[model samples]
Target: MVKGEVCSEGLGPCDDTCNSKCTSKYPNGKGSCDSISNSCKCFYQCLQPKPEICNVGIGTCSTACNDQCCNGNCAAKFPGAYEGHGVCYNVGPSIYNYCVCIFKC
Candidate 1:
């Protein structure tokens, strides 16, 4: 979640000082962490962060996404279990599949 406010003077281009853990996905000075403003924002772009706080009855509404979703929001669409073998098995109608025992049930 990049805040809209960014200090370009002291920080130099965001790319140069980008925090890898915080702002690695974007290039071109995007995903800047504004220490003064305490917010993060991508340059010339808009992206809503995942709803960390969900309203009543909303059950943590899925994250705003474009085309294909990833990370947080992905659980909303494909609920399943992956055993590190790159296999995902859907448990039921909702997200979150039961983990299968490696040995046996």
Candidate 2:
């Protein structure tokens, strides 16, 4: 049920400021929060691609995944669900227009 933009587990880098919740994952100056936006502030090196605003239908589809898939996109493949495994696929704009969840197994 996790929706919206998926955050990357990987931080910008040791040279960049990271999120407050995740600063301990990096060194001192490598992670901090911007008081205004209250978001992780990073040095220029941590710059990454912004999440894309896609549509449903053509870009629309649906899939489910485990914790591993929660943070990013996983290529479509498989015999579908295995055992208690969840599905992992793209969804539509109504439900979503991006990877909804990530998988671990």
Candidate 3:
């Protein structure tokens, strides 16, 4: 596994405060303040590959609906992607839901 920096927030100079904030956000990750950037950076082992955003469109919370809309659209747009590799997530309130697809880059 490779260690990766997932989050970084600038909070003035390096101090105990930066360490505390990083630990609070990621319990399993290490937080250190970089003097060069003057930011608190969180480091952790990234087991899974980072997913790339494939497509975003209107969709419902139902898996069937999302599968039809998101999977179909993602396959059409990115033909090289493996079949059923696209995953759709429903976000926003119940009144207005949107589909977001994350697939292999």
TM-score of each candidate structure, all chains considered together: 0.17, 0.22, 0.33
Whole-model lDDT values for every prediction: 0.29, 0.33, 0.48
Residue 40 shift from truth in candidate 2, angstroms = 8.3
Query: Best-fitting candidate, measured by TM-score?
Result: 3
Candidate 1 lDDT over residue span 14-72, tens digit each: 34345552344434344566554444534322223421111111122122422233333
Candidate 2 least-lDDT 10 residues: 77-86
Off by over 4 Å in 2: 1-18, 26-96
Regions of model 3 farther than 4 Å from truth: 1-13, 47-105
Q: Which one wins by TM-score: 1 or 3?
A: 3
Q: Which 10 consecutive residues of model 1 have the lowest summed lDDT? A: 51-60
lDDT of 3: 0.48
Candidate 1 clash pair list:
2-40, 2-41, 3-39, 3-40, 3-41
